[model samples]
Target: MARISTKSLTNRASWLVLRRNRIMTIGETVGILRDNDDFLVVTHIRPDGDTIGSASALCYALRKIGKTAYLYNNPQFGDSYPWLAEPYLAPEGFEPKYTVCVDMADKGLYPEGFKGSADLCIDHHPSNSLYAKNTLLWPHKASCGEIVMELVKELCGLDAEVSELLYVAVSTDTGCFVYGNTTGETLNAASELCFAGARNAFLNKILFRTSSKARLALEAQILSSFLYYHDGKTVISVVTKEMLEKAGANEKDCQDIAALPGRAEGAFTSVTIKEIDENSCKISFRTNGLVDANKVCAMFGGGGHKMASGCTIKMNSFKAADTLADIIGEEYK
Candidate 1:
């Protein structure tokens, strides 16, 4: 695939914004939700706050409008944001008139064996696959949650549940509003949610300020395995399944671990490799503004935001680590 220039990417976003008749708007989306009695919202495979919050908020807003809505079953839900997803699980074989996917850029990101197509896709990734029949994509937005907020506003459902859910979605994706993606619009959306009853201080403590013992131990093990290259301009960290076992940690305890290597002093690019199996691993790339992490991950058929992206490699963890480091360094060389 060829690299997309900033000019072309910006033009694509602007075109989507102007061609509202082709892509669905918040009002059109609301009309769909209102007309459909049975709605099911699906998040990405490895659930994150943005996906979970966006789906959960959409489900809640649908229910508030007296529509039947449920969250699709995601195995990783319990690991990330259980509170937001617990009460919304779709019952077994619940047929949905409208199957909507939130925060999923590619169809491959949907859970395994989910063969049905989505009626709509709501997302913020610049590289969205446009796999749905109708898409509401705002690449300029910091998080899908920000777009969800617009839907909630149009539906007149800006209560505490919606507020806090959007807060989680926006905050997690933007790294508590400190990431390069964070813009004035993002902060303003967060402020509105706060005024509407999002407990920002409390959520900040739970999501950022606090960590469990297992998580701390896992972090220590990962840090111990950190490797540097390119004169410390590139860094890599590994966390094997055995390491997680030794730390008494599971998937839930490894939240934000991918960003650990990038926080190193003088690091320009970082990679985190997590062993999913003996022969395969998941790799995440983080960059400090100059190198586009999306471009690095795209080399492996994966892409996300410019600063953060990920892919899965069918190679041993150690080899995957070395390969990712080499590719990232080569990209910036």
Candidate 2:
């Protein structure tokens, strides 16, 4: 969690200049789109709020302009996101001349069936491999939703659908605006979405509402599995195969319980380990400040932003715990 030095900033900036997107500015993106007539929208495998918001917002805008755009993602995404409108459509034999990746840099993140070149990538992640003919990687932007908001304003102005989609993208990426990434620009854009009829009540009722019996039982189990250290400065928990099965829990239920440990007093990081199977585990890392989870994630062949990031460990449960602890311990050194 060490702050990036001046040298690091210089390096990142130079890299940006060599392969920056001129259409990152709203005016430029709109001009490019107005002339183009085909697009295929795609996102990372486990689509989050930013992915859902950006893909729907951009696809909807494209359709508004009389262009045809198709959407596709891993099937597991549908299971995790029941509240969404299922904007991704993939009819058999459907194809597009160009594909658009939203909120992601690498096409490999799209799971097995979705592997190929994308014509464009609208993303804010630094790990992006520039896997598109045209790309926009804005680390300073709070979310891909923010980038799409810029596009919405420039292309056709904000409408009701655009407002709702953009709101979900921004709110979720910022952790309800409580995270460090929220900025004045994000707030202003959110306000515009509100004015265009984005309803907070409707979004929350669906996103947070628990309807599964397994989910309730899993929550109870997670509440009791807590372990603390350093005067409660660190909180850790594990969800093993046995624990999950006894609770009738599934991977979708694991998502919500992952962030609970950061609630502990004096804690800088909350680590949640969920056994994806007997040999592999998914790790969710959340930090209040000064603990870069992305560094830990990178060690496991995964990458994301600093404060809220994730990684997958291919080792068994015991080795996974040791690996996580060691990586986090290095941050303290």
Candidate 3:
């Protein structure tokens, strides 16, 4: 496996042309995998089960097929998904000949301080920025794990470990098959993974059935902070730095916190604003089909699927919540 060098102007132009031609089909992606060795898989910032599971599963599949693979040590990888990605983490100073990003929608979502571009991107986000040299995108799939499952099936048969990891990827992104984004295809893939020895019941119990005390407290604060607009159709919940402090919560405890406001019976559009700093807030938007969450998030230059999307607002949590409320409220008029 020879590494492609971009040391000269001519080689750089050639690389660009090669990349343009490499917006690949699944078969082409499989071919790339079979031909490459020494891979480094990258997860997105604020690593979730989907990103971690997909990257871990891909690394397992790659290594199973006799390729050397490791996962990039994402800075935001807290202890949230304990031990799941630890075995695959790349050692210090290891240089990969090929870089693969899984479940990442864009280069901007790359783990903090990650440099250079990916050789391949496997993602299911409709808003994918196509930042990789080669991309295998399935915008209609419920999770990037589904795409990775296909790749693994093609590369090497799915073993129990890979199946379990992919189950994590699929189930988490779809909110344990309860989110509106889940489809028949998603269920079918999950079923197949189960047949391949995925411990669905055990995984479901750990991932969904359990919650920490801090998580429960954070949910309480989020629910109490909800501000309704548009006759209860649009709800915005603010989680200030103080709220996290009060709840004894950290980022790990705040996973899926955005879904709290959307659980309100009459809310069609829900927004969760988390204070990142005094001047900036991270926004997560969810909709029950009445409004496009992607479009709403795009107002602040972010996007994802129609049912769930997110963005960052250059305002305090309260201001960002009010601003998003106004924006969502106007949609009903």
| Residue lDDT tens for model 3, 1-333 | 123345632656667754573567888899999999999999998999999999999999999989999999987788458477999999999999999999988899988878958899999888886678888888889899999999999999888889999999999999999888899999999999999999999999999889889888888877877898888888888889898898898888988888788888898888888889999999988998778889888888999998899999898788787788777777767
TM-score of each: 0.91, 0.87, 0.92
**What is the lDDT of every predicted structure here?**
0.86, 0.73, 0.87
lDDT of 2 by residue, 1-333 (tens): 122234644476655643543324455557667877667788787777788788888888888778887677557665466345366475767777777888986666774488667777788876666657677667677788988888877777888878888888888787667666788988887888889889866775665554478878877777687776545666778778888798887767665566567766678888888877778988888876577877778888877777777778888866677667767777877
Sorting all predicted structures by TM-score, with the top scorer first, yields 3, 1, 2
Cand. 3 Cα-lDDT: 0.87
Where is model 2 more than 4 Å wrong at Cα? 1-24, 82-88, 209-211
Clashes of each: 0, 0, 0
Stretches of candidate 1 exceeding 4 Å from the true structure:
1-22
TM-score of 3: 0.92
- Sort every candidate by lDDT, greatest first: 3, 1, 2
Residue pairs with backbone atoms closer than 3 Å in model 2 (clashes): none
Model 1 lDDT, full chain set? 0.86
Question: Candidate 2 vs candidate 3: which has greater lDDT?
Answer: 3
